[model samples]
Target chain A: EAGVTQSPTHLIKTRGQQATLRCSPISGHTSVYWYQQALGLGLQFLLWYDEGEERNRGNFPPRFSGRQFPNYSSELNVNALELEDSALYLCASSSRLGYEQFFGPGTRLTVL
Target chain B: QQQVKQSPQSLIVQKGGISIINCAYENTAFDYFPWYQQFPGKGPALLIAIRPDVSEKKEGRFTISFNKSAKQFSLHIMDSQPGDSATYFCAARWGGTSYGKLTFGQGTILTVHP
Candidate 1:
């Protein structure tokens, strides 16, 4: 079976602009999660969506938001992007709430 | 605040030697511990995981030793190979409300020299 897949393998945007990243979960997976990995840093949880509802989010600012579709696909949107936002945004999916997560290659977002 | 703390920011191990990475968590509520391996420019992949009920779990050459009372866990790679060189991360997650969210460690870059 295919693992999680992300779109726009790489993205570029200017400060104050908006950026949207997409993710499709593996078949039979119902939970989608978003994480941000800054250069030389570990992954930071961004958001979690289960059954098309926002479950929980991390300590990130309000500008970082995302939603999951009925099909278990997810989109992470960053508004007023800052230079610090330039990082790898990863998406993961799990079959259930407490199962192991399968991650995608991630979308590298560069803010200029 | 870093809930999970990992040590030995970088490690160097000879091929066929043993490589060990240690991590300690602050939250006793965290019951699920997992280790992830990531290559350059790639997302982290789950290496192995264990629950609080078990003290150890091994898969192939990878093993996880968990200490529930100490709130610590360590990943040991036996017969390490150059192909196993990568950044390893230890993570923890608790059930109920934080069920699917994982708190990750800073990560350890391992280089296995052949």
Candidate 2:
């Protein structure tokens, strides 16, 4: 089975611009999660989508948001991106709540 | 609040030695603990995991030792190898919460010299 897959292995954006990252969950998975891995910040949870609904979120600001599609794919949208917004955005998918999450390669966003 | 705290931001060991990394959590609600290993430019992969019920779990050369009362846990990589060099993250989640909703500690970079 194919694991989680993400698009745009690397992305560069100017400050105040917008960036969109995409993720495709493994087959038959219903929950998709977004996380930011910034330098020295570890992994911070960004958003969680399950069963096509916004289930939970992390401590990130409003500028960070995402959605899950009917097919279980996900998209993370960061608007008015700041230099601090530059980081590796990781996507993970699981078959159910509390199960192991399979991660994607992640998109490295560089803001200047 | 940095609910989970990991120690020794970095570690170095010789091949054939044992490498250990420690982590502690403040929330008593955390019932599931898991460790992840990541290589440069790649996402982390689940290394080993343990539920509060078990004090320890070992798989091959990797072992997870937990101290429920202390709210602490650790990962030990036996027979360290050069290829094992990477960043290690320790994460925790509560009951019924999906593993995606994890609280991660600052990663520890492990380097094994051949």
Candidate 3:
């Protein structure tokens, strides 16, 4: 089976601009998750979406937000992007709430 | 706040030797504890996982040893190979969280030399 897939493998944006990252979960998966991997830093949870509903979120700021579509795909939007926003944004999916999560290739976001 | 702490920011081991990485958690509920392997350019992939009830779980040459009392867990790579070099992360999640909404460690970069 195809694992999670993300779009715009690489994205470049400037300070104060906005960036949008997309993710398509694996087939038959209902829960989608977003995370930020900043260079040497480890992965930090960003948001969680399940069955078209916003389930939970992480410690990130309000400027960082996202939504899940009816088809279980997800989008992460970072507004007022700052240099600190530059990182590899990863997406993952699972069939249930507490199952194995499969991750995507990730999108490398560069904010200048 | 829940947290997963990983040790040895980096490690180097000769080929065919054993490589071990350690992690500790703050006891945030619990249903799953997982380890992920990632190369330089790719996202992490689940290497192996264990539930709290099990003291240890093994797959292939990889093994995870969990100590419930100490709230510590570790990953042991037996017969470590050069190809096994990569960044390995330990993560945990409680019952109220989603599958991927995990509390991850800082990650350990393992370098196995030939």
Candidate 4:
């Protein structure tokens, strides 16, 4: 089975612009999650989507939002991106609600 | 209260040696602990995981030792190889509210010298 897959391996944007990252979960997986990994900082949970609904989100600002599709794929949208938002955005998928997550290669977003 | 603390920011282990990484969590509600290994420019892959009920779980050369009383867990890699060099992360998840959202620790970079 294929693991989680992400799009736009690298993305570059300027301050105040909007950035969208996409993730396709593995087949038969129903839960999707997003995480941000910044330099020197550990992975920070961003969002969780399951059954096409937003389940939980981290302490990030309102600008960081995302939604899951019926197929379990997810898209993370960062509005008014800031320099601090420049980081690797990783997505993961799990078969069930509380199962082990399998991660994708992640999309590296660079905000200037 | 959801923080997972990991130690030894970096480790240098000789090939054929044992590599150990430790993680301590403060949330007693967290019942699932997992370890991940990531290569440069790649996403993390699940190495092994354990539930609070089990004290230890071993798979191949990887092992997870969980101490529920102390709220700590560790990953042990026996017979380490050069290919085993990578960044390792420990994560925890609770059952109440987060819905499997994981709180990860600052990763530990392991370098196995041949």
lDDT string for model 3 (A1-112, tens) is 8889999999999999999999999999999999999976678889989999888898899999999998999999999999999999999998876568889999999998
Native-referenced DockQ of model 1: 0.81
What is candidate 2's lDDT per residue for B84-105, written digit by digit as tens? 9999999997555443488899
Q: Candidate 1, residues B1-114: lDDT per residue as tens digits?
A: 889999889999999999999999888778689899999989899989999999999999999999888888999999999999999999997677676798899999999999
CAPRI category for model 1: high
Q: Tens digits of per-residue lDDT for model 3 on B1-114?
A: 438899989999999999999999886576689999999899999999999999999999999999988999999999999999999999997675343568889999999999
Candidate 1 lDDT: 0.92
**How many clashing residue pairs, candidate 1?**
0
Model 4 per-residue lDDT tens digits across residues B7-96: 989999999999999999988878799999999999999999999999999999999999998989999999999999999999998678
- Chain A TM-score of model 3 versus the true structure? 0.97
Model 1 Cα shift for residue A66 (angstroms):
1.0
Tens-digit per-residue lDDT, A1-112, candidate 2: 8999999999999999999999999999999999999997889989999999988899888989888899999999999999999899999888876558778999999999
> Candidates' interface RMSDs, in order?
1.1, 1.9, 1.8, 0.7
DockQ of each: 0.81, 0.67, 0.72, 0.90
Against the hidden reference, what TM-scores do the models get? 0.98, 0.96, 0.96, 0.98
lDDT of 1 at A22: 98
Candidate 2 overall lDDT versus native: 0.91
How much is the lDDT of residue A103 in candidate 4?
98
Q: Model 1, range A1-112, lDDT digits (tens) per residue?
A: 8899999999999999999999999999999999999977678999999999999999899999999988889999999999999999999999876469889999999999
